[model samples]
Target: MAGPQETESTQITTEAPAKPATPEPKKKAARSRRAKAEATQPAVSKRSRQSPKAAEAPAPATRAPRKTYSEKERAHKLSQIEKTIVGGATIKNAVGQAGISEQTYYQWKKAAAPASESDDLKDLLALEEENKRLKKMLAEHLRKENAELKNKLGLA
Candidate 1:
């Protein structure tokens, strides 16, 4: 009696799992149809090319629409994305949370950074140049003062 009940419960659970599994076959069927369509396409195209009257119009390209973001918006999204990544979230999760696709995230990451990063680099370079100039001037002034003092003391 116990063995039959255990088997029955397993059978019920198996049925429940099977329901989800059923959808995969439908997906595979759809993919097979697509494959068949693609497989036949080249043959048809080749034949059409040989026949002057069978010119087929080109298929329209399918692409996701481009979204334009302002500099502030892009910076905000990038910061949020970076925070999520630093918090140990995967890139897929971070981008999903930011409501942007992986493609968009990668595109933004690859392209030039927002103006802030470049501006900081420029400022650092300018400060380095100014520091060099000031150091040279201070050294020259000290050398001149030292010469004058040595002449007064007859040391030079």
Candidate 2:
């Protein structure tokens, strides 16, 4: 019984794993079909010449050049839009009548603001920087004073 069991286990261990047979046949069949198809079909060049009808078709109409507004034109348009708005027309309607988009109108308005406003902003930014510098200086001075006091009190 022991001899038979050992022989059975050795046979099982020595046997090779069986591979699936269906996939290899399918791949070979596909390759043969593709080979037959390619042989029957004529090869085509990528850049074939256009047909007479396509060549004779008139070229598409060229687009008109885009109109660029100068500063004077932009300011005039912005003012016209504002006047219409002041006369109780909706901003959208005013901007449309002025031949400009609302976003463009806002951009022009922002750009046309008084220089004094920007000057004030610059001054405010300068003051904020000074404040930060002063704060840092004060903090460092306090830290040094604290250390000195600690030394005098024998806490360090």
Candidate 3:
């Protein structure tokens, strides 16, 4: 009877501590699960909230197509820009007034620079023409020589 009583008392003591420890671990697990659920819920809610706002927002404005300018128009714009500059305005303001970009203004200026040196360009053109004429004359002379050789050999 004593041995049985001791065994029962030990079992009761151990089970009492185990019951308390088990509840603590369960409580901690419940808290962690709640935290995970809370974290996931906010992210899902944020995505859902942003979707409607994105759909309701106006579409981004489309860019305009590029404009093409003729050579005469370009020349007129360049002159206008130059006159504005001569009147003490900056290049930016000058180009803007002429309805052209700074890059276009600079490009037109560079192209016009060569035209100012017409004498050099004219001389270059004349030299090229003379070279072509000489080449034609040389080709004709060679053909005549080839024909003379073929006639002497009686294979013309």
Query: Which candidate has the highest lDDT of all?
Result: 1
| Candidate 1: residue 34 Cα off by (Å) | 17
lDDT of 2 by residue, 1-156 (tens): 479889998887667345443556444444587789787775644443356665576655666677789988987888788789899999999999987778888887888786548889999999999999999999999999999999999999
The residue-by-residue lDDT of candidate 1 on 1-156, one tens digit each, is 579889999989989976774455443444587788787665555766777565556544667678789867977898999999999999999999998999999888766464568889999999999999999999999999999999999999
Root-mean-square deviation of Cα positions for candidate 2 versus the true structure, in angstroms:
26.4
lDDT of 3: 0.83
Considering summed lDDT, which 10 consecutive residues are worst modelled in model 3? Answer: 21-30
What are the RMSD figures for all models against the true structure? 18.4, 26.4, 17.2
Rank list by lDDT: 1, 3, 2
Which stretches of candidate 3 lie above 4 Å from their native place? 1-60, 119-156
lDDT of each: 0.84, 0.81, 0.83
Total clashes in model 3, counting residue pairs 3 or more apart in sequence or in different chains: 0
What's the count of clashing pairs in each model shown?
0, 0, 0
The alpha-carbon deviation from the true structure for residue 80 of candidate 1, after best TM-score superposition, in angstroms, is 1.9
Compare the candidates by TM-score and give the number of the best one. 1
